[model samples]
Target: MNLALHSVSYAGVWPGQERLSLEEFIPRAAALGFKGVMLVAKRPHLSLLDYPSHQPEKRQALRALLAEHDLSVHSLAGYNDFTVGPERPDVPFWEHQIVYIAELAALAHDLDCPAIRIFTGYNRDGLSYDAGWTSVVTGLQEAARLVADFGVVLTVQNHHDIAVDYESMYQLLSEVDHPNCRAAFDAWSPAVQGLHGNELAAAVRRMAPFTAYTTVADYVALPRYRYEPALVNYVEEPARMLGVPLGEGLIDYGTFFDTLIETGYTGTVAYEMCSSLRDGGNLDSLDAYARQFQDYMSPYVAKANAGVAAATAR
Candidate 1:
């Protein structure tokens, strides 16, 4: 498995820190020892509208930058929500997203990226469970078809509301039915969902065949407290998750990665600092965390590479 740094780590969307441009981010990722990068297809990075089909110069510039940094374009992540606006026939949000995905697919092909990342929609009001599910399937199918022409696959990350768990993700990928549609399965969601040991391993095995990539991040839940006037006591609110270095968090990446490596996952393992961190989101902090991730993931990367090597020898 190749190690890639997702641009969102420094994009600063969550913590309100200043975002880094792709020009600055590419070299930083390479400096942090990332072999490749997953560029967020949004502002402060590479948006679809900014790098349209007609803009060969923009693509060329990005390619040149990647070469200068000695980095590869692992994937382009598109922000999508297919569940909302399910009842609005007059609105064109869904159509625009499909077109945007197709555009991103073209850009991925131009940059020699094999995959594009997307999210399923969050379950919102005005949409029934069954209706929301059908919408996701249809949207992904269309997106898959659009990208398939470029030989680019759509890897659905488990960040969204639909198809987050192992069983649902497998079912979603199977239902999409497009050869280009696959899962970007992550350990965080399954870990948070309470899967562990053989159960988690079995889930990983089930999604292994359809999984082309996985995003990794570690987090620890911070307990929250709220004052209650009626009871004259402080009530415990839900714990807020804060990002931390790999081994310091609650995620069981040891078992998670062991299962994936043994299953012969020859895909990219992306490290992301997506939430509020233990330290602030400054470049110094980001760089430190990023380097820590590479160090933490070294053994797993070795394991995955050895698995590939053994399979090839066979």
Candidate 2:
């Protein structure tokens, strides 16, 4: 298992986090001992507007930078929601996203990245659930076909609303039925959905076969309360999830990693600090968290690698 530091950790999307350019991020990730990186495919990183497919020079420069740091780009993360404009049916939003992914796929090929991570659609007010499902299925099918030409696989992460659970994500991948389409499964969603212990292990096993990539971020749920002046009391509200360093939060990564290893998942596992974190999101905090992930996952990675070596020896 190749450990990758996702660029989003330093992309400054989270409050108080400082943004780092791809040039700055590459060497820093190498300094932190990561074997590779997972780049966020947007501004402050590898945006299409910045690294257009026609601009081979920019891609080459970026490739050279990665080589200088002895780092490989394992995957590129893309942002798209196929059910965004259900009310505006005439807008052709789906087509626009498909084209966007195609361009990203081209960029990934140039960067020597094998996969592009994408999400399914969120539930829309004007669209029925069935309609949203169909939109994602067809959209992924087309996107998968488009990226295949570039030798880039489209990894549908279980991040969005359409098919986030393991069962539904498995069904979604199976329904797409394209060789270029695969899973970028993560434990965060299932953990938040109250799956744990044996149940969580089951979920991982169910999606293991289809999973080609994954991202890790530990989080703790902070319970909230609302003031009710009339009743002179506080009303309990839904909890707010906050990110934390790996192994310091509620996620059962030990179980998660054990299952992945047992199932022969020797794919890229990326660490991301994409949300408001408990220790705040300054560069020091981010680096510490990143280092913590590296420390936490080292043994599991070593065991997985040893298993692969043993299999080859036979």
State which candidate has the highest TM-score.
Answer: 2
What tens digits encode model 1's per-residue C-alpha lDDT throughout 176-230?
Answer: 9988999999988888888878888888899988989999999999899999999
Q: Please list the residue runs of candidate 1 whose C-alpha ends up more than 4 Å from where it truly belongs after superposition.
A: 16-18
Model 2 agreement with the true structure over 1-314: per-residue lDDT tens digits: 98999999999897798889888999999999998999999998889999987778999999999999999999999999988887787899999999999999989988889999999999978799999999999999999999999999999999999999999999999999999999999999999899888998999899987999999999889999999999999999989999988998898989999999999999999999999999998889999999999999989999999999999999
Cα miss at 128, model 1 (Å)? 0.1
lDDT of each: 0.88, 0.93
Residue range with the least summed lDDT across 10 consecutive positions in model 1 = 10-19
Best by lDDT: 2
- Prediction RMSDs, each to the true structure: 1.3, 0.9
Worst 10 residues of 2 by lDDT: 82-91
Q: For candidate 2, list the clashing residue pairs, or say none.
A: none
